[model samples]
Target: MSPKQRILELREQIRYHNYRYYVLDDPEISDAEFDRLMQELKALEAEHPELITPDSPTQTVGSSILEPPFTPVPHPTRMYSLGNAFSQQDIAEFEASIARFLGREGPFAYVLEYKIDGLSVNLVYEEGVLVRGLTRGDGVVGEDVTPNLLAIPDFPRRLPEAWDLEVRGEVYLPLQTFLELNARLEEEGEVPFKNPRNAAAGSLRQKDPKISARRGLRGLFYGVGRPETLGVRTQQALLERLAELGFAVEPHHRLVSGVEGVEAGYRAMLEQRRALPFEADGITVKLNELSLWDELGYTAKTPRFAIAYKFPAEERPTRVRQVVFQVGRTGRVTPVAELEPILLEGSTVSRVTLHNESYVQELGLRVGDTVLVHKAGGVIPEVLRVLTEAPRGQTPVVWPSRCPECASELVLSGKIHLCPNPLCPAKAFEAIRHYASRRAMDIQGLGEKLIEQLLASGKVRDAADLYQLKKEDLVPLERMGEKSAQNLLNQIEASKNRGLERLLFALGIPQVGESTARALARRFGHLDRILEASVEELDAVPDIAEATASAIHQALSRPEMRRFIERLRAAGMRFEAREKQKSQALEGLTFVLTGELSLPREEVARWLEAHGARVASSVSRKTHYVVAGAGAGSKLAKAQELGIPVLDEQGLRALLREKVGQEP
Candidate 1:
């Protein structure tokens, strides 16, 4: 076939595969196979540049001209954010207001849907084909994301037979996909996305339709754009019709007859929310009748017809009794505040993270300060604020100059203080603890308390030391039995085979997170190469900021640090041994990944990092590449405007394998 024909065929095949994998959740070809086809197409296009077309899969990443700021288009019906009711009393008040408005309400029912934590989108369909999609910019007007929206599988490129219609829904990424995508980004030395919501928002705003398509973004239709077209007089009917049209509708939507029922539905949704696939911060309670929605109308920024019953803020107040400093696996000193007993979101709060010295200084917190402590999303406990009036005599907490566990003097590297002594007992304890973490070594029987006991008893001083412990050594320690000791040993033995990335992460270098570790592994491909890297060489790696580079350099230069690394090397720690491969396809290319992917992002990142490419976390003019996955959000759009090259996983792999004669 001619090069032109081959390029077109390759594009068609990729688009079809995208539809199958993203929209249908079924893929006929293996990833490697799909990559091979893409490689062939890219090669053909490169040889005959004249064959490149606007719609070609290879063109998605390099477009730099951004369409001007999105002009606001008026919504047929003004979209409104909901008013939140934080408590049952608040809900009761709302119910009373509704009853008064309706005049002697005999029965009123409510429908409950999970309040998806994502960007809101308005899709316009003319004659059953999607024409344009817009962001819920300001409820009444939004930015056009027509191209990006078209890429979404569930978005319905062609709608059901209808004259004209508009549908409202959320654009989001699934948790599983999010985790995998972030892992890959990390592997490429790119910063992982913060959350699923952010990822979704970024994906929908990409300028290139093809880029958006590559990221597996999906939309769930919830409300109608023009109620008149649906011949629907009630919200319940509108939702049912949407579902009937094959849109992914919220499964828990229900219609209850009155206020009591509404309350019950709200509670029920809250209870079952955890089981849902997507993240939901609250439940949305909307008026069931469309006519009533008009009657209730809207306020300036919110609709009166609907009220969002927000889950209580997961916050609680506790007294700060004292501050404690702890050394992390990387030897960074972290300050933790001990809190007085307080109940918070069903759990007793005793302590919270103060992060680093910078955080503590920002809060101007002191010992004996009464502080509001709460877990952000019922997960990580953090100090929200300090109540100054609670105690005037409280002293300012002093940061320790020496490590608490081992009296090593703390060294300051920019904002963070570090326990630079390689043999510091606390640092060793942290390293060992991290090695046994679920994501690391998967050591099942080793809990923090147990680890503390073992450390206190001097049975294990380093991560490798755990491998040397005898059954009797552990069995005698606190609650450890023969079975538990054996289990722990088995886990340690299993960990010996963990790949280079995990080992790099377990080493706990300053500012070297899981993602950074993966990048280092892929770039250096061996522990010895990394350990021997000078500060300047380390700094040259992508995303290795100045501070982090210096810290790693200083740490490795120490005799103790060298000894530790040598010990690990002697103990048979595995490292990447292959010569660096080269791929001209992605050479001089940089990528910034946003959102989630089906495969672990780390795998993709490793491939790229090893193939003479750069991957970044945030968007910038210097960025040469963007490998957007599902729910890519704003970064995708930003990349397009900046004229950065964007690639899907398949395209990226193909690019890496190009120019077989050279090393990646």
Candidate 2:
């Protein structure tokens, strides 16, 4: 055979074996044999890039280079999230609702499949060739994660036959894999994912596909966007067809005749859930017949034909060893429960936040008390209740009179405790980290370890001190080589020009989020103006609540804050705002944007908001315009059905330019 023919042959063989091992749970060839075939294919492709195919198994390793914020891809059909049913009564009510909607006295046949606790994704195929993979970003448009999707061994690169189709699935990390990944993260001193679902999501969103390949993510095909395209009539038939086409369909699905069958299936799955390799929080029950799906229709957020029967939250008994105080960047003191190390939902549970003083009092919790801890949805370990009272030698939980990190007297404000000292070490550390966050200065190389080093050495006392650091100063820190130190210094210098809004946010003013900062920047046009503005003047700005205004007023009036502002101004930071929009062209209009756009949705929203347009997340009669792009889903359909004005990207841009009489 010619080299091209041999490569094609090898690809087919490898794809078949991948299907056998990953989808069918059977292996026709050893790993060594598969590696040999893959190596030959890779060498051949490297020699002749022109012969390379998108679906080549070699591409599954992903690109060596990383690219952030993957481009958005629209789904052919809306990936509606399922409404949850926590109790048996909720399930019965759901059945009754379906019957009511169908106007039928008899119970409807349904299919029950385990709802994998993972990331929802859609894979599109053209002529039996895998073309694109997308995340379920907003039910309409999603980030194009084709490369990452290909990294999963179970994610098919080609179908059995040449056919156009779209299959929806849950991409997940198995429980064992999740535990190992978290262990590795813990070893690296990096924060581990709270659950398998979060781990799967984080893995799939990695900028480098190679990272995803190592994550051991598996996909289970469950639903079809258009089953008729593949000659499938029922949900069960759809799953079977998908399996035949070399997709991993969850094997535990049951086809039940009526509500009773659904109840039985639910019970069986709940009992057997622990035996499954992956985490499944619930069982999804969908109407069996595809013909009735449309008739049953959908609500705004979920499909009416289906509902998820969630299992009860997993609870375990553990002792609260201590209640410690954590001071946030804004000086708010929160009580945190330090629990005895115990495994919960595949992760080690060591700590849970108490939120505030009121929360601590409400639980009547004390040190050495055995408490019932549970992880709801397999995330956020929380203290459910006190299972056993404090032991005889245990003491009542004491509220600290002063900040632990700094000797500042604690003050009660409403239900929460405040450290009040702006210069508190804990607050300074948190403030510096927040200032360097992506949403603020976006200092790429400045992370927790480096910031901690700077704090300890007294090289940086506040956010402004960051701009003054030199390469020589950073090089001495652990893990900071000369090159890395220089890069960090470069990033810090670049951040000085991030403009007035970002500077306002980076200042760490209490109650001033990005939106409020943007509003203040636009209204005053200069940092000096904002600093000089009275509380009444600040309250007059749009979107600035009275409380927020008061907080900003108090924060800026402090002597320490005034000195900090002066230091920032001395560092050559950009303090003047950008030009304000001259016209309120879309003053009375509200727009809902859906699907892929030339620019990001947030950027579009910001521009529209600058011109006095209200951006609504959903479509309604009140929405004056719907900006629809490629692959626009239910929102687009709803807009057209509701007689709401719809505009494509080009049309929307044109309208904006025409209204403002200038480029946006």
Q: All candidates: CA RMSD in angstroms?
A: 16.9, 19.5
Candidate 1 lDDT score at position 591:
69
Among all candidates shown, the one with the greatest TM-score: 1
The residue-level lDDT of candidate 2 at 410 comes to 68
Candidate lDDT values, in order: 0.69, 0.77
Candidate 2, position 289, lDDT: 92
lDDT of 2 by residue, 54-74 (tens): 667664421111232666666
> What are the clash counts of all predictions, listed in order?
25, 1
Instruction: Give the CA lDDT, 0 to 100, for residue 150 in model 2.
Output: 86
